[model samples]
Target: MNVTDPKANLAALIKCPSVTPAEGGALGALTEMLSPLGFKVERSTETDENTPDIENLYARLGGEGPHLMFAGHTDVVPVGDEAAWTHPPFAAEIADGQMYGRGAVDMKGGIACFVAAAARYIEKHGKLPGSLSFLITGDEEADAVNGTIKLLERMAKAGETWDACLVGEPTNPDKLGEMIKIGRRGSISGWITVFGTQGHAAYPHLADNPLRGAVQLANALMEVPFDQGTDEFPPTNLEVTSIDTGNAATNVIPAAAKVVFNIRFNDLWTADSVKQEIITRLDKAARTGNLRGERPPVRYEIAWSIRPSHVFLTRDDKLISSLAGAVESVVGERPKLSTTGGTSDARFIKDYCPVVEFGLVGQTMHMVDERVALADLETLTQIYETFIERWFADART
Candidate 1:
């Protein structure tokens, strides 16, 4: 089987506007495509009181040991200003050898290529050498409250596990095979609030001036470096994203000040350690700062958002070597194993099993007229097919 042509499959997927939290029939289309290949496809919908019900799919073809899973999401980010595009965002039009659509590069393209690759592998070998499965979700781009995390729980409850997993997120920055994400930097967000007395600006002796305390606190946090980084990750960084006092008048000092900051940390620190460091620095600053008699010294409260993502590295030799070999075979160059990106669903999947991300060049993902080269899609399909073959052939079971 020719795998039903990856380009055609991608075009069909692009036509479905399955934005975050909405299925848009994309999973249905996938199920239809996989069912004919002797795959046992299961569609699961997870519901939460706070989030919309999301539809996910897990499909498998072989059932023995050494299971290899391909993980991805079908949901595309919102298309901003549809009229601004040269072609419709959902048209999936192929012009000048490029497929233009919202998710052509970000993700849908990867799913299409994998499906075609799997079909071709089965056609050539009559059956996969080992188990093959796909874990797809529809809530990766939004709050993520009801997406892959829920699906993984369901899978675990059902006694499912994998030897290794590949996340088909768009990882390449410039070229098709320049980078493969082997790890990701950890992320943490914090909100700091400082309390003081409010008074008229004219009466300097009466006003406590919370802004002054906030400024001092911000300086203390920014003055020192978080860490020098490790061999696998870059140095940690903290940046104040916003500062708010809610004061509108020029003459009145605000009673409180708030600063919002985020840190993209490395392997050198954990969320608790980072928080403790911040508190220590702020306390030191507060002790040294001066304030009017009517107002007490600077007092602050710090709150953290969701739990921070712990830095993770994938060192599994077999998974890395096989995927890298396949990439080199198809792209003519060994891809760089990098950990220099933001975050992805892999942050959640890493807890379950070792995971690596590789896919098409992502130079235009989440940008206007987002698209992928038709030739690149074909090449990626070949790479996935090759990787699947080699990975299973090398399996012990």
Candidate 2:
């Protein structure tokens, strides 16, 4: 099948219900597309103790220097209330110029467009001037344990290296070329548990409520700003996702309370420094808080979530300018270079090489009817094709 048509490629991928860990034939479909284009495609299934084994693909064309990698995921979040969708989430149905599917915009659409772009480039030039590879994974929407991180490690260990990478995450908020992600904020999550005495509600004087200390600590984390906004990034922000007590009866004060929070920090701090800052705030709140009524530092403990994502920025001029120029040439406007979104697989890729992200509009991602416009898909294909030509040209010079 001719893979130059992005609409056709996206529809084939969308028809596979490749929800995390489920292969769902999405990788197989992708293989079919890349193989015919003369890509030496290799698929690996990575496994960890508890995470479901992941299916990842690395396909390379040409055996030369200045390798460029297009990174993205095939798996999608579960379709919530399948009945709520206008069309079946895996049907790849089209309605009024939009193609609706689970990964339509966040981001099977991106992968489809890139594949089509590569195919078109091959069709036009016969072969690329430099190496081009697709680093596709099936674990982005879940635990993420057995996906890109592992695939990258395996590839690097085998001596595979890339000069730069482009992540096909849904980056635009409203339009196709509105934004391009040059960096991402770091993320860390922790659970705080405070211990107290259980007692009757009427015995307030005798009972120590853990909820009081938990709220105090939670407030401290949010009340103070992490930092003023930076030039390349927004100010760090922390949110209390949940505060819970297992107590069933309102009259009985719970013996313990837990506060769950996640912080998105900027370049102003590293993961360790941000963690230290959090500890300082918690300690200060515990010592000075009146909620415990002089109860010896409001005993508490913290358990950090595993594998915090680190913050990073890409300063590769040629890579950024090539993509930016491509978008401007195709869309008639230079895209804004930004670092405003939550963390992504780009965070992992950044450690290996300079990385940036660009893709379809993200308004409907993870929504009831996630989708992409056909016109936007075509435009994105053009942008990717132009980027391919420009990146290789710039690398040669």
lDDT tens per residue, model 1, 80-148: 999889989999998999999999988999999999999888888897777899999998888777888
Candidate 1: residue 66 Cα off by (Å): 1.0
- Pairs with steric clashes in candidate 2: none
For model 1, the stretches where C-alpha displacement exceeds 4 angstroms are 1-3, 248-251, 289-296
Q: Write the per-residue lDDT of candidate 2 for residues 1-397, one digit (tens) a residue.
A: 7699999999999999998889999999999999989999999999999778898999999898789999999999999899999899999999999999999998899999999999999999996888999999988888788999999999999889999999999999989999999999999999999998899999977778999999999999999898997999999999999999988897998899999999999999999999999999999999996665667777899999799999999999999999999999999999999999887899899999999999999999999999999999999999999999999999899
lDDT of 1 at 180: 90
The alpha-carbon deviation from the true structure for residue 210 of candidate 2, after best TM-score superposition, in angstroms, is 0.3
Clashing pairs in 1: none
Q: State each model's CA lDDT, in order.
A: 0.88, 0.94
Q: What TM-score, computed on C-alpha atoms, does each candidate reach?
A: 0.94, 0.98
Error of 1 at 245 (Å): 2.9
Q: What is the lDDT of residue 68 in candidate 1?
A: 94
